[model samples]
Target chain A: MAKILVVDDSNFQRNQILRAIKDDGYEIFTAENGKIGFDLFEEHSPDCILTDLNMPELDGLGLLKLIREKNTDVPVIVLSSDTQELTAEKCKNLGATDFMNKPFKKDQLKAVLEKVFQ
Target chain B: MILTPDQEDAIKEFINIGAGHAAGALSELTESHVKLSIPAIKVVKLADLEKEDDSFTKEISSSVRINFKGFTDGTAALVFPPASALKLVSLVSDEEFGTPDMDSVQAGILTEIGNIILNHILGAIGNIFQQHLEYNVANYVEGEIIKLIEPDDSTPDLVIMIIDTQFNLKDLEITGDVVIFFKLGSLTKFVEAVENVLS
Candidate 1:
């Protein structure tokens, strides 16, 4: 199983993603915010990273930039509930592998993960 | 800025119905009983929001805030104490809680849950008003307090609803607010709609 890192400020959101991926048998790691997420990224070097866009401390965009600066190849997905089109486009420009809107469906998440892992 | 008595009553009724829909959505998703209470609804000037010293974060061990916009110009925040959030994760994942990565997974789940509940509530509002409303995808954030205000330089009156409730799955207590900011023109329509409904 590939190792995965999930980062978001909310414990509830992080847990939901963890539960979805755990059945896949992947080694999972989590962080509460961008700063912690960045720290864990260095610690685990996970196969994939899923993060929220708006967070206290450091936001997803900032974390993505930091991760990109360190390593460009790892898949990073931007997950957010923000409806503004500009934000989604900005995430892509920043080198995010993909983007998913909040309140994502189980199948939708699984599909994205499968694509990333593939 | 003035709402007739009938208009106020209609707005309250509409919000209550929307809250019920949100509770139902949560129940279906978690397969648990959801209890929601509508404590009050207030319309405040954007400037006045700063005066309300509400600390949902201090009361809860940990909290999650998700925001959605588009169909309605507002934010729907879901705040869960740390213990409550963890318990929810455990129930959904069916994994013994040993601190499995908190950032990615929990944020994802909370984002989705927030999206569903917010959508349900907003969708209910749309239905009541006979208007089609679409929402931006939901996202998760953490803080002591999460507020949705009109952008700087834009002064718009907003309707704020405080909802206190608990989810049956592990008895997680969630308290949050749904904020809707109406444009000057839409405000008129809203008042008219409320009047029509109540009349």
Candidate 2:
């Protein structure tokens, strides 16, 4: 089973995303902030990571930027409430696999992850 | 969305855009330069759930609510005391409607004001994130502040932003509470966009 890391300061969001992808048989691990997210990433070595852009301590971008230094192969999908071209472009430049807008449907999350995994 | 310094500043600026837009609309409406600014933005829990006798929730205030959509979708309201609401009605209309309670006509005026304020804010927010948003017709509801905004499926660990804005009618203060109820799930994305601008 593929393991996925979910990082978000919002518990509600974390649960929503996790629930959307949980039934896929992927082991989902969650962190409240970037620092913990990175620590878990190092330990769990998730196949893919889904992170929220804004968080306390360290944010999703901050984590992605740091992770790129050590491991550029790990696929990271960035989720944000607002969709700004500049931000999405920057995330892509930082080696992000994809960028998604929030209030994502279950099918949307599943389809993206399926594509990434394939 | 935990009130980090960066997130806090971003939220304040976000609200500032909405406030500025609302003020602009009011200026155009009244032909007077209305001064509207948000002094503080704080994440607050629902008063009814937090305290039994919350002074903030004690007042018999009237509210005009609009459905805020795009990014973080939910309800946004401009809540004020009944007298203040009446005064606002008086400023906008040519009729003498100085009643303690908001009559149907006064309520209609309040609804229009609420729609104006919300549309301005929603437009500013939607434009900021490069998204288009549409809000439903503004609804006027009178009662406790918490009850007015609280959703049917109560959020447990719920926290909302209290945008304190001072609406001025030429040196006179129009005391109103700009309360927004968000589907917190979507705020994660909203904050994400703010961080994008910051980064």
DockQ of all candidate complexes = 0.09, 0.01
> Which tens-of-lDDT digit does each residue in A1-118 have in candidate 1?
6988898876667766776777887888888789999999998889999998767788898899999998568999987754344567778999999998655667789999999888
Give one digit per residue, the lDDT tens place, for model 2 in A1-30.
899999976555676687787779999999
Tens digit of lDDT per residue, candidate 1, span B78-101? 666656666665655555567733
Model 2, span B1-199: residue lDDT tens: 4768988888788778877767776665455778987877766555334553323457778888766566676777888877777877777654577458787767876766676676666656776777655455457898877666656625764556667777898567887878777676656767787777778
Q: How far out, in Å, is residue B56 in model 2?
A: 4.1
Off by over 4 Å in 1: A1-118, B1-8, B57-72, B80-84, B95-102, B144-172, B183-188
- State how far residue B164 of model 1 sits from its true place (Å): 4.5
On TM-score, the candidate that comes out on top is 2
Best by DockQ: 1
For every candidate, C-alpha RMSD to the true structure in Å: 8.6, 16.7
Stretches > 4 Å off in candidate 2: A1-118, B47-56
